[model samples]
Target: MRDGELLAFAEEERFVREKTAVNRYPAHAVKFCLEYGGIDITEVTSIAFGWNAQKYAFVSGGSQMEQFYDSLSKIYSKDVKTLASEKEILLRFQPERIESTLFQALSEVGIRVSKKSPTIQYFSHHHCHAASAFFCSGFASSSILTIDGSGEETCLALWEGRGSQIQITERVELPNSLGWLYSCFTEYLGFRPYRDEGKVMALAAYGRPDTNLERVFDKVTGLVESFPFYRVDPNYIFYGRHSYGRRFTDKLVTELGAPREPCFEVDQVSADIAYQLQKRLEDAVLSFLRHTLAKRPKNNLCLAGGVALNCKLNRVLATEQKEGLFEGFFIQPLSSDAGTALGAALLENYRIGLGRHVPLKHLYWGPNFSNDEISGVLRKSGVKYNRVSSVATEAAQLLSEGSVVAWFQGRAEAGPRALGNRSILANPTSSRHAEAVNLKLKRREPWRPFGSSMLLDAADDILIRSEAAPFMIQSFLVKDSFRKQIPAVVHIDGSTRPQTVTRENELLHEILEKFRDLTGMPLVLNTSFNGLNEPLVNTPDEAIETYLGSDLDALIIGEFVIKRNGTSPSDLDS
Candidate 1:
């Protein structure tokens, strides 16, 4: 979860196969908690709901449930089957509606439950998102900010986390959200709003801002001096489909192009829309940073939220922070809704129990498999695999010669990224290796650069001078002296999100050290093992599925290394 705060959590999406089961209270999510926690009903003393809708509605004067239905029906389609399946959704969904739909589902599941309010305590949605991210950052204290499309009523919030305690200093609520502004452009471009914002971010790198972000937002919200990032509205703007007061202006479409209907193929219209959006967002953030940093001005910052997932904006933050500004950074991996669950529980744990903040140390917070299980999988898969004497050295040798290896071991990571355990290992020497993997096998955008995993100490000399970045969050400038040494991980901007390997990541450390010896560089190009919209591989079969389905050259699990199609673990398919 965001900042490794989840001892347990689940997404409502996983339970229902719908594109996004939005606006619905997380009934199945809560049910997963009861099952995962493995206790009798009411045995648990605490529960943390991800969204505090009552507080949000009061703050923004908007309808949470109404917006939910509007967004969901639009994206997933108004199919009768989808509406029918709504009946089978868990009984934990409430605010009062759970009494009708959820009670029956609970009955079918063999819980003879009488209806009472579920014991869920609410935390501000973005607060939970930020808290989850910061707590998992391994930082005792930092300036924490959560920015996303409006949550409840809040779009942006500022806080300070010290030890196990956090205090919110400032918050910018709805109608002023940078998230919704980005999503609106996402719609105008005809890409799926929530799903394709990343595509918009990628598209931004290829163009310049032309469409006026400020002009669009000014029609309904207030004044937009700084353009797309923040507005000077007297109150927050709510941009749901049902919103009447305009946070989006008709003038924006006039200046740019006609607003796109939902689900149109992305053309030049979409690309230009994305371009304007990315540029304006950067302008808005730099403007907000000038304000926020004036008060806090700490070298280190902690950020969480769905918008925080934007790597390019993160790059700008890094450069500005490093110019004698903020000294360090940590962005939560689970920086979205699922992470809020972890943050809510952790917030309660800190608020009530110790009344102190907890420091983060590592990200290995998911399920781990046994060594026997690893062995069993290799034998069952019928691959020519062996528990090698030194898996790190063997794997390093292969990667040094340009082999693309899939590494799956230990616990699965909680969020979207593959830290090390569930990563695909590749050489840092060439972009062609990345291109082959992305275009031919994994089927991802060629434009999106992968990340680098390197030993902590080794990073000081090569990537940046004494740059002690542990997590792959903020970007580091690729030193001009060694640009060609590691071309695979470097972005077009000559930066890379470096995950510094430490003794804490002992297995990862060994691999990096071996690669250092073999290739004279301590860095490896690492990306998550999953392909496209699938989840990370959590079981042996999942690992096998990834190994066989893709163009990866090898599968290395624990000490066991297996090759595909008689291709040595050290060579590309060439």
Candidate 2:
């Protein structure tokens, strides 16, 4: 690891598919960092894991590490030999047991080194979540907040990020989660518990939840007897049953109508549930913030955790702050579990007082491919394309000509926001263009407005929050004058989540600059590279497949731009 280079990643994203993937370990991700940094394994000073078994899943029967192995042995029930060698079985299942496995996996990927490895340890999950936001926020001093389902022994934490250090202000422990409440709403809507919460948020704006949410929220808000906000019955795992969370879910089902079944299309009830979820979370965040700011003088807030990813809740927070609620918003783009990697690294750096803080100006820190690499893929895949000397200029011209373009530039964006690479670019001048995208490319809910990415200097000319929305966290008013000019990016409330691009994000800035020279406007309508039900395109192949399958006019993959050869929807022989 470099002086401040704390490489962090999640097991689930690395594996691509798995639940509670915490079991697998980020072997590939770890190898990527070491090889990419050109650092030797022995030279590496520290290795930090984003999870802590001791605090997270370590049961007290004397190291759940032991318990996990014992339980896992039952899975291999046929291994009756393992029953005779119980210690061997116990040794096999501990995460520590897999330490060597990680080293072996890394080697298979050509990342070989010494067996001793680097100094290793685990950071508290919330601490890392807090650091990921508060530190990157560029706030020398500010109140930091992290709210999620559960991390270690706590779910919500209040901290103060001052200089290169962080101090925990206060925290609310597990079972008391605003994040869990939001998830409950997801369940009530018949959406996937952890995965489809955002769908609910998008659906919320479509229907009116005429029910008195405030009165209903009183059902489980203040305190559950002795617990803070809500409590968990320790007898059940993850605040309640395994597949489902809290026992209160039964109460929730009894209160609300029967949950819609999955594969059953969205309806009014789903919309109402979405509406209530958004409404309740906003109220709770406001309450939490009021209490927080009342105790501190800082006007700025550093938001993270899964809850912070809710742009609707974030918009509500921004509204309050604009009315002098909080001074500024610096919500980390990777505010979910994926961010815990950054947090884990930063936490270690702070404890040892080993590195200088680097204020993040953009979120394009993931892997980047060169023109050669893209061309190599094009040649290998047998995809025909006109390779360009100036990719951005060519892509912009295509966009101005009303071509939906798959705009892949530099590295893949580090977070959910497609700041630069892995984005579909189009004109924001027409609402119908967005509709066309929905009817064809994205196939996403029409209510979910595509995000806006504008030249850093031109941000003030179009949207509110003129200067500090580099991370695309806060929502800003659509400068009444520019709303009509860029309706595709504006939400129904006239607020928009904008990616403020600057020279710091040189590739991204250059792309927008090129577009500006062609279109007179500095913004490009940007959306995630994926379609309706797919994950963001992580590899070149995924990007190419999306371009070839969708209605996009052309795809600028690195310097190789592929112009679509197909009949336009308008050209169809009806």
Candidate 3:
């Protein structure tokens, strides 16, 4: 965004259909953003890549074969040894080879390159994370915190932002990372480390944090009193590794019991392990924040990184009681590596004096489909659809009647969340709807809870809130009276992650209003529009294919509504 206006923003995953685009260059995403802004590559002024590869250039480039063998030995099994070795080789040579590889990739994507290519710049990974948070926090000055798995040589950073400029105050180097700590636990719990940390958070709510587990966590992450940082005990978990294999050592397994197998039932031990890890993480972050804010006082706080995606921990930072600490908090909606792209662009814009410090309002920056495009796809697929005059009303009626609706409209969301754009909507008032959607439609785990899309005005009434949460990045306690009223959206702990819709989301707000008028409820059960293990639908065809394959009662795309042969408007009330 330039001058506080969103010209264009998108995720590479939306174009590639991959959950994460870590190794792939965002060629399609770049093209779409340029086209959306009505500009050409030559017209672009500067390009800032998210990672600073030069930081790793000092690593000794010994025999590539020996380094490869060492990488294989680090893995748990020989089945994936080759893949791990290849990845290690790539990582080892990436610093020197990245520039030429990037140039070639860009050239293949039709971007012009030469000795000087639009003043290409590189941003340190954590710098982009900090920029994405502080620049868009809407505060004239804020205390910025970015924490993630090892980025270059750093894992965490603290900065102070004042009048469009940020000054780094502290940095915690690699091998002492909170993100890696959590990710290690995630792997031990039989979940994908980076992708399924939220599952661990949810599971933690179901168990009690054991004293022994807490003691182990405290020892693993030894927080320093003199310094605002913690040291990760490498004895328990691997500190430096590129593979997804087991990072937890035999000592960790002895301390926390055997690792949970994937798809196994969530036992008490696994839940307790998750609970202890979460508690320890919260303690570490709170301590760090207190120390940082004391040295450099700031009322507003901005957070960005993969760790910031932990809504449970975010809740503690936002609501925790601490003297002379932050009173206001803003977390980047896309607080993951995917968001580094946006952060890089914003940092470059600020450096070039083409950016304005403004708080971000919404995240509907991806590609949008027109009515014509929707019609063409429907026709090509030979599917029957009606061009409804009011898609909102039709969708609202369906929700009021207890039918699940795949609601696809406007631009796709840029983050891992669906928000209102690409979502599966169901009646939040039905107690059984959560199970029905999980089993019949989504085929997801029964323990996984659903989120909600609620009117902004109704948020306070339903949730215990101290701030506005436009993104579903924080969980709030649902009011006692409304727990049974919105059973499908409430978790076992009687809390909910809600996307509070306002005028900025005009269409979604209108649909919520219609739903409220019909059912006297102000929210709908909302979840990402995808089946189990599938990335969210990106294109119109993917949306249609998912809709037809699932047991969804109806599909709403743009102004069109497609329903199964026997499904009718009357089916909504039944």
Off by over 4 Å in 1: 1-43, 55-94, 97-118, 133-142, 161-165, 209-229, 232-253, 258-275, 295-300, 324-328, 382-384, 464-466, 567-574
Clash pairs (backbone) in predicted model 2 = none
lDDT of 1 by residue, 90-117 (tens): 2233334534454455555555454453
Candidate 2 weakest lDDT stretch, 10 residues = 234-243
Query: What would the per-residue lDDT of candidate 2 be over residues 23-88, giving only the tens digit for each residue?
Result: 455666666566667766778767666667443233567564455444544542323333344445
Best of the two (1, 3) by lDDT: 3
Stretches of model 3 off by over 4 angstroms after superposition: 1-5, 58-96, 107-116, 239-244, 263-265, 321-324, 566-574
Q: Which of the numbered candidates is closest to the native, going by highest lDDT?
A: 3
Question: What is the alpha-carbon lDDT of model 3 when measured against the actual structure?
Answer: 0.79
Candidate 1: residue 356 Cα off by (Å)? 4.0
- Clashes (N, CA, C under 3 Å) per candidate: 15, 0, 1
Q: Give residue 519's error in model 3 in angstroms.
A: 1.5
The positional error of residue 236 in candidate 2, measured at the CA in angstroms, is: 13
Instruction: Give the TM-score comparing model 2 with the true structure, all chains together.
Output: 0.83
